[model samples]
Target: MQAPQTKEEKQLDISLDELIYKVRELKQSIAGFIYKLENEYQHISWPNMMEHFGVLSSQLNSVKRLLKTSKMPLLRNYVLFPLRLSPDRDLELEKLTEGRVMAFSHEVVPDYLRTKPEPEVEERVQMMSVKASSMAPDTTQKQLTNLNKITANLLDTISVPSASDEREKDSSLKNALPQTSSQQDTNLLIGAITKGHRLLRPEPQSPMVVGPQMGQMQPQMQQQHPHKLQMPGASMGRMPSAIKTNIKAAATSHPYQRP
Candidate 1:
């Protein structure tokens, strides 16, 4: 049988349900706004359209903040919350919220906010149009010529680097990079070599055989070599001839010098 949930787990489930309710409310609010935008304000002017966009934008941000602050991992997984009316509704809500936010930012807001030649903008547009219609063809051509000259002067004033300047910049970057890289490479190589030497270097071998058996061999070794017994903790059995030769060779050899 499955164990019952602790108090904390029960509280967490309650909080998560409350969070889902808030998200659902926000989603309904966005749906209502979209409905109004489509039906009530089918041909909204710039100012009125922006006011609607602002309300929707603020609602979306609040939903985003709610999702962020909830700190509940299960809310992100659609499969976990099967108790809801629609198991996949939370995922759909997230997608709808994101889509609305993007639509407002990209399509509706930018188009409405941009300067357009609207009749309500000012009387200047009408005046300009009337003046353009009354102007002589030769005089218009002269004005166009002057405008082109002014644009060309502006373009000339915007400095662009020459091929030589680009080449110099490329060469300087290339020169600076190699010196630093070479120094770093050399240091790394030396460090690797030093580490290898330290790892491969022979350590002083301790006598493997110890205790009672080793103690028993002391007297026999003393008779064979009396002077050697004077050394402290000296083992009585001399190491095998082959092992002695190998140990001496290892001790004498330098790590850098290959065998």
Candidate 2:
């Protein structure tokens, strides 16, 4: 029988045939190295790496199917060359295995069909019923009332300031008052004394003219006696002396001391 084929078909067949040969060669080389490690480098025998190789074999089979399905020319070559050469034994491979195991347990395994019965929902419902049965229908209202009472008590306790707080507030107010009050009182008393002095002791009316008349009158008025203005025959000199004496007596009579 003659094998009839197109140019594309022949090329495809040739590539596929070459890929199969390379795959077989790669598997043989890998098996030979694994045997050598097991017998000779037994101490460094990577059971884990070997396990990965088994998984890698399965991956290669998957790649074989992919190559057939996709008709990609280069996939087999990429898979084959590395398989023929031994990989370095490293912790990276161990970590990969750990990750794969984790993925299997956490992501892959749980998604697999679960045969175990789930009693959690039923148990939760039953527990809820049991709790419900243990309490009266009015229990929620009673609890609400009790909670309100507790909250009211808590708020009252917080809102009402303690004795210490009140004392501190009062003390703060008292301390603040005296600092401002004493200074204000001193200013008020000084102002009152100045006002009273202006009212009771009016200055002599300024001389109408600003020349010698005022100047002459200023000394005369300063030298003039107070009793002459009010008494019958006292001299201006005696009047001033009496006014000085009377003013000193009046100043001594006042109870308030000068600031």
**Candidate 1 per-residue lDDT over residues 50-111, each given as its tens digit:** 77678767877766676676455455344332232332225554576664433333334435
The C-alpha stretches of model 2 lying farther than 4 A from their native spots are 1-4, 47-55, 58-62, 72-259
Consecutive 10-residue window with the lowest summed lDDT within model 2:
195-204
Measured against the true structure, the TM-scores of the candidates, in listed sequence, are 0.26, 0.21
Best candidate according to lDDT = 1
lDDT (0 to 1) per candidate: 0.56, 0.54
| lDDT for each residue of candidate 2 in 1-259, tens digit (9 for 90 to 100) | 2355475566667777767666766666677767767786756548856875776577577656756765555543433222222233445544855443332223333334344435897788889999978888699779989999999999888865553366677686665445555765564456436433111222224324345444434444443232223212222223334334577677876689475
Per-residue error at 91 for model 1, in Å?
22
Against the hidden true structure, what lDDT does model 1 obtain?
0.56
